[model samples]
Target: MDPAIASKVLPQGLRNRLSASVRLAPDPRVHYPGSDFPAALADAHILISGWGCPALTGDVLAHAPGLRAVMHAAGSVKSLVGEAVWRRGITVSSAADANAAPVVSHTLALITLAVRRTLSMAAGYREGWPAFEARSGADGRTVGIVGASRIGRRVITGLAKADAGYRLLVSDPCLADEDARLLGAERVELADLCRHSDVVSIHAPLLHETSGLFDAALLSLIPDGGALVNTARGPIVDTAALTAECASGRLEAYLDVTDPEPLPADHALLNLPNVLVTPHIAGAQGDEVTRLGRYAVEEVERWVAGRPLLGEVTRQALPRLA
Candidate 1:
């Protein structure tokens, strides 16, 4: 973690609790691998990691003979944890569960706006007020979830609890028909979900198999005037195909992530009236960061008490997880 983040996450009070429970590094901010980093790891039993923490490799682990565990204060340990850490039998935990809450909430809010055609309406305001018949209702609107991930599951739960009576459809390889029913959703193939959904929200991980998953053909399956919402990794959707869809005014989108993130200045998607392209702001940020900090602190507490980690990450499960 960066030094500034270390201070915010482990303010004086939490730092004291950590110190009382176990030995801590004199400085908790080890963001990079360097000579000083190895010396700092000497005699350390655990590492408190965060967003900027460097990858743990063989050379780095050689210096920390006593390290047994790592508690990360951020989501996605894919970049933070390497083969060396797992080979050493070191326990690892992530604060992804804490991070999922804000993403789900933000995504749901976007869905609400999308279902009502807020962007298209606002874009055409200068022309004239939309006729009553042109306005859409949220009631009985079909929403499709592309992945049954942590965030996806929470979004399904949110849809179930909403007063709008949304019809939920989910497409995930691992989700069974019974499981979808339990979540108040219908298990459908991706193409079927796209064909039926009024709003489609993506919550899948970025993997070799998932890259460009929403290409021209799949994206074309969406009904006219439908909206697409993406809070997941950018490459999962075809950037060029999406631009063409929104360019023709056939579909609307609320994209929090982009294939070429921070798309070029003249990118078509940036200027589209019906598309809401935001920098990735759906996850924890500002005040919400405290939740990740609190979760990491509790994980550390649990570890000290010899309890199973709440956010445990095993090497075998990494490929299937976000």
Candidate 2:
């Protein structure tokens, strides 16, 4: 893991516990495969990896003969894990569940604003106050969820319990009818969801099949003046298509992640009044960083106690996970 994060996440007390229990590395430091990392991995038994850590390739694993478990203090392990780690039977865990809470809350807040046409209304304020007919209500509005991911399911539950009484529609190949009903959502095809929804919130992970899932055609199906909220990975929605939609004032979008992140400073999406492009801030940060630490600590304690890991990740499950 990056030494900077390791120090803060595993404070002295937790570090002492970890050190006392296992043959932890003398220095809880080792990042990518470069520099002094090979020497650090020479005798390490368990690896605590985090963001910016390079992939654990076969060559890298060769340096750590005793490494058996990996605890990731970050969200996705896609960039860190590879075939080599799995072949070695190395157990993996991630703090993605811990990170989902903030993203769900941010998405829900955006949904509330979307239902009320907040952005468009605010944009139009400079011209004049919105007419009574132009204003929209949150109550009974249809909200479309692109995937039944961990965050998506939570958003569904939150929306279901809200006073707004939103009609939730979800689109995911893996989501069954019973599960959708139980989540208080109606399972629908992507096109139908877009066509009827007043606001569409994307929660799908970025997979080969899901890449460019919301293309020009699908985005066009959304009702005029409808809002699109995506806290999910970018590239799932075509940036050009979205730019054109918002530019025309036909749609509004709240984007925390963009295809080409930090979007080429002068991108038109940045100037659009109805489009909001944030710097991928829907996940844990600031005070919320402690949640990740606590979750990782609990996971480590469970692993030490021979209990099942709450944040465990497996080779078979990685493809479908975010």
Candidate 3:
């Protein structure tokens, strides 16, 4: 883990628990992209990794001859793992599951607001209170989920159990009809999902095929006054097309991630009242970060006890992950 966030991620109390199970390195400091990094890994049997850790390239791995596993205290090992780690046959795990609860909760909150026309209605407040006929709620509204990825699945589950009586529709080529039905959703094609949904939430991975999926033509299919939510990657939605829709007040966008991400200071989307662009904070942050450290530490204990790891990642599954 990076020293900068070590206190929050692995505080003294957790460190004491960790110390009881594994031998603390002689130098209990941290480094990566530093002269002392290689020396730190010299006699390691297991590596506890997190954000800011260097990719385990072959050269870096050479320093840890006996390293058997890596427990990452963060989401997505895609950027941290490489061909070298897999070739060495080392076990790898991520704290993505632990990080997912917050994103799922945030996304669900966004969906609740979107279905209620919260942003548009709030924008209308300056002119005068919205008419009783113009107001709406989540009850009986159809919500489209773009991909049934890990976080997406949880969002669907949340919607399914809502008393608001949401009609759930999911879009993912990998989905089976039975799977959708079991999740209390109907599986549909992407265009069909866009055409009929009152709100479309993106959960798909950003792949070559998914890039710009909600292009001008498809975005135009969303009913006038509908909303679009992207808690996934930014490139999956066409920024220019989305901006035009929101600017016209014909649609609302709740975006947690954006294409240029952080967007330019003067981007039209930022100035739109009905469109929201958050700083990718739907995931864990603040005190919630402690969950990731706890998850990673638990995985370490499981591996040491010869128990099956709960969050293992394999080379074959990296492409499908966020």
lDDT of 1 at 240: 93
lDDT tens readout by residue for model 1, 1-322: 7766666666777777778788777666545544377667888888888877778889888989999999999999999788899899999999999999999999999999999999999988889988999999899899999999999999999989996879999999999999999998999999999999999999999999999999989999999999999999999999999999999999999999998998998999999999999999999887677778788889988999999899999999998777
lDDT on C-alpha atoms for all candidate structures: 0.90, 0.88, 0.91
Residue-level error in angstroms, candidate 1, position 307? 0.6
Q: Considering only N, C-alpha and C atoms within 3 Å, which residue pairs clash in candidate 3? A: none
Per-residue CA lDDT of candidate 2, range 296-321, in tens?
77777788889999999999999988
TM-score of each: 0.96, 0.96, 0.96
After superposing candidate 2 on the true structure, give the runs of residues whose Cα lies further than 4 Å from its correct spot: 29-34
Model 1: how far residue 173 lies from native, Å: 1.0
Query: Candidate 3 deviates by what RMSD?
Result: 1.4
Give a tens-digit lDDT track for model 3, residues 52-104: 88888899889889988999998988889999999999999999999999999
For each of the candidates, the C-alpha root-mean-square deviation to the true structure, in angstroms, is: 1.5, 1.5, 1.4
List where candidate 1 sits over 4 angstroms from the true fold: 29-35
Q: Could you tell me how far off, in angstroms, the CA of residue 182 lies in candidate 1 after the best superposition?
A: 0.7
